[model samples]
Target chain A: MFAVHTEDLRKEFTLKKGLFERRTAVAVDNISLTVKEGQAVAFIGPNGAGKSTTIKMLTGILKPSSGKAQVLGLDPWRQRSRLVRQIGAVFGQRSQLWLHLPPKDSFELLAEIYSLDKKSKQYKSRLEMLIERFELAAFLNTPVRKLSLGERMRAEIAASLLHRPRLLLLDEPTIGIDVVARQRLRELLAQWNREEGLTVFLTSHDTGDIEAVADRVILINHGRVIIDDTIDGVRHYGAPKSADTGEPPDMQSLPALEKVLSDLFTAK
Target chain B: MLKTAQKLIAVAKISARANLAYPGEVLGRGTFLLVVLYIFLKLWQATYSESGQSKLAGLSLAEMLWYLTITESMWMSAPKLAQQVDEDVRTGSLAVKLIRPLSYPLYCLSANMGERLVRFSFNLALGACIALALVGPIHLRAEALLMLALSVCLAFLLDGLGHLIVGLSAFWLEDTSGLYLIYTRLTMILGGMLIPLDLFPGWLKNLVVYLPFPYLVWGPVHLLSTPQAELAASFLELAIRQLACLVALSALVALLWQRALRRVSAHGG
Candidate 1:
């Protein structure tokens, strides 16, 4: 079974004015997609392009106006609490941790929320492993308010993973971090993807985040999927071909990848 | 049920620990509330002297002062659930909260209760100091005091639920602070925050007693000042009314939260 599947899901919002006037906005139009288990899918789109909206619907934060979505064979909206138990989510700009307390406290609180056996050896080792893997030992005791954006993001991801979720959904996870921090985050996510076979559904605009971590790319615009292909297929699109033989464009240049994406973003 | 309790306790504990991080802010607000109490003491004393009555509406001067102290402590230290909910909804941060395996309203209620309990303790102690300095000591029977504590705890839940209802209006309205301000004023006058209900005209007192607002502040404060002989009778009557209000308010929260969830889903957050 696919880790994620949606069939023509849609969401409509109505806005009302002072008197009798109303306007309807279609945030997520008829959109259907699927992700295989352990697939690293990068959902890239422009601003206001329904990427986050789709993720929200799939994660049960929002209910679709029409159609259906099943994450791990369970209806996302109907089984939200149960679904959330097996899925992790992180929003780069929003925090789930208490700002005034250390990440250590947040983690403990999360453990309780997830009903983990904190005294068991397996849970203890897993906690230690995550701490070590994320390199959170140094700043784990510091208040979240005092941490830099990058550190807080890392901590947020760590806390989300304490439940050992099978699928991880990230919304703009690398939006505002420095180069080194972003690179580190990308590497850590890649490791989780490769070693643990964790299914990842990520929404991001950053080319580096997509290139380094995602194997499959789904480009969306105006509430519809424009392109769904492997990274190689994406790289090959709109590149300069050899004049005489109509050969595939060279993939070695970084500019060619950026050009292809820029053209795709600007295309009708 | 046990696991749910454990999780809620953890949530509350974390919230309480977060509250401890802002000692200076707590102290500043506590001091400000103490000043308000002192001013009320002076105002009440002058009003009694001018009226040339040793007692006004069934309460002695000292009893009235103590009643004000209890109500003010509750009012001043109540959690800002409405503003917090409004901000969360507006900023879309509430989406993060929704994904957790917890009810958003319950989480907010638990967190608010934890923080309010801490702040209430600090305010209660400070108000006691001011009350003693101004009105001298007012003796209380142990049973009446116990009943007062029970009523106040229920009042906190009732008040918090009321705030939640107001806060959830943000799901439909653009802002809820204005509504909360109105609610606070209504609760103050109609709920006996500013003056005892007995002091009000009989018709007005009777009408106000039927609403949940009276149970929020007036009921508890009234019990706190009741004589020991009548404590049992008064406590039983008040408990029944408060429980009825609690059930009704809890139902309202459940219904409104369900509606808010629909709005949130439609709006893509």
Candidate 2:
């Protein structure tokens, strides 16, 4: 079964041009895609490429202008309350943690919000697993306001996972962390996707994030899917032909991968 | 239904804990409360002396000061519900809240009430200390205290709904500050925050008594200062009015909330 399926999903926003003039701007235009269960897919796009719009529709934050979307076999917009219980999302630019409270407190509140019995064996085991796996023990008691960016992001992701959501949507989850921390986050995400059989839908401009976490990459631009292929396929597409040997540039190096992705974005 | 209540109560507890995280802010508010109570004491003392009356608006000098103390504490303790909602809408942070398995309006209402309760408690404690030092103690009755507690809780719910109504306008309005400012000013002036409703002219008092604002401040505080015999009788009448206002405001909030959801563009991607 597909974790996510959208058939010609579209969203049009009405833009007020003036006192009397109104124009319709298509944000996600006739986009069709599907992600298999437990598949890790990176939905990447340049700014204004409607990546967020599609995610919003999939998560039932906004109703599509037309077409249909099903996440975990449920109509997202119609069954949002039920769907949300099975889905976890983290918007790196936004926060779900209370700024002034410690991560532990926020996690406790989230457990209640999700209606997980605090004393149940399942809830306790899951919380313990997240705490250990996320390496949150050292700073769990510290207020979110005092935690470093990396520590905070780890806590944020752990908080999202508290309910054992089947599908996880991460939008730029590693946007502003140092290299070591970013690599650690990426590794943990990949581990979760692999070991837990969790479907991962991620969006990030950073090539390293995509390379490390996604098995497949879906590129969208101007409200349409421009390219949908395996990570290797996209990497090869970005690799430039070397002049001396008539061979493709090395896709292994981070800089080389970044350059290729940059070329692809601008070329498209 | 019980589960929903549990979730809301959890949110409120978290919010209250967060509000206490910054001790300096709470201390600052308490300090401000002291200055305001002292000023009220002096101003009211002079007003009574000039009028050549030991009582004004059926309240002794002590009762007037106590009444002002409650109103001032409430005014100072108000959580910035409308502004917070405005920021959430403007910044697209509301999107994060929407995906949660909870009602956003109810979550917000719970959080607001929790924060307000904490701040109100602190302000009232400090204000009471100042009132005691300045005007001595006013007569109190056990039943009156019970009535005051019930009335204050209802007032918080009603006021939170009022703020939510103003805040949800952010879905349509570019900014809600102006509207919130107007709402608060009306609550302060027409709600008898500075003076007792009994002191207003007969026609104006009659008109204001029917509005929700008076119930938010005057009614509950007045109950606290009332004599034992009259407390039960007035409490019943005031409680009924407060409940009626709560029903009306809650309806408006529910309606506005539904409309607001349709307007959620989640602008900043």
Candidate 3:
């Protein structure tokens, strides 16, 4: 079964120009795509490309202007409460942590919010695994306000996973972090996708994130999907050929891949 | 249903904990409460002597000062709920809240109540000490204290609902601060924060009694000041009015929230 399926999805926002005047902006314009269960797909686009709008629609935070969307075989707009239980999201710019409290408290509160049995074996094991995997034990009791951005984001991801969601939606999860922390996050995400078979829907401008985590790349521009292909396909589709082998540049490393993707985006 | 309640309670607990994280700020607020209580005590003293009555509106100068203390503490402890909601809406952080499985309105209500409870406890404690120093202790009954406790809880819930209603108006209004200012001022004047309802002209008191404002402050505080024998009867009447207001405000909040959902245009990526 598909984890996410949308058919001709659209979202238009109305703006008030002045008294007795209104303008309609099409944010997500008739986009249709699907991600099979456990597929790690990257949703990338330039600003105002409606990537966020599409994510919002799928998360049931905003109603679509038209078309159909089913998440986990449930209608997002009509059955958001139920759908939200099976899905988790991390918007890098927005925090779910209580700023004044430690991550431990936030995690405890989240366990309650998700109605997880705190004393259950499953809950205990999941918490232990997340703590170990996310490297959260060191600062778990430190207040969120005092934690470094990297620590907080690690905690944020761990908190989202506490419910054992089948699908995870991440928006720029590695943005604004040091290189070491960024690589660690990317590795963790890729590991989660590979081992847990979690369906990952990531949106990021960082090519390193795309290279390390996403298996498939779905690029959108002006509210429509422009390209959908495997990461290697995307890398070689428009990349400059090498003088030595008449093949794409050796974009095996982070910096080289980043330059290729940057060139691709610029060419688009 | 039980699970929902537990979720709300958890949210409240976390909010309370977060509010307590900054002891210096809470203590700063306590200092301000001390000053306000002192000012009210002096002003009420002057009013009592000038009137040449030991009691005005059936309250001795001491009871009057005590009443002011309770009302001021309640006012000072109010969480900036409307402003928080306004910020959430304006900044698009509301989207983060909506993604959660819990109802957004209930989550907000719980958080507000939690913060308010902690702040109110601190303010009331300090205010009580100041009141004790200024006017000595007024005669009190155990039953009156129980009634005060119950009514105060209901009052906070009712007031939180009112703030939620104002905050939800942010979906349409360019800004909610003006609306919040007006709402609070109305509560202060009509809710009898500055003066007891008993002191209002008979017509004004009668009018405000029919509104929710009086129930938020006057009704609850009045229950504490009532004679012991009448405490039960006053509480019964006040509880009924408060429940009725709760029902109406809750319905309005539900409606506003449903409409607000459709208007959500999350601001940024």
Model 1 CAPRI quality:
medium
In angstroms, give how far residue A243 of model 2 lies from its true place: 10
**For residues B64-162, what per-residue lDDT tens digits would candidate 2 score against the true structure?**
988898899988888999888888888888989999999998999999989989989988898888889888987788788788879998898888998
Error of 3 at B105 (Å): 0.5
Candidate 2's residue-wise lDDT over A174-193, tens digit each?
A: 98899999999999999999
Indicate the residue-level lDDT of A22 in model 1. Answer: 95
**Global lDDT of each model?**
0.87, 0.89, 0.90
Docking class of 3: medium
* Candidate number with the higher DockQ (2 or 3): 3
DockQ of each: 0.63, 0.71, 0.77
* Model 3 lDDT tens row, B143-251: 8888888888899999999999899999999988889999999999999999999889999988888899998888888877788778888899999999999999999
How would the candidate models be sorted by DockQ, starting from the highest? 3, 2, 1
Best-performing candidate as measured by DockQ: 3
* Candidate 1 residue-wise lDDT at A266: 88
Better of 1 and 3 by DockQ: 3
lDDT of 1 at B218: 88
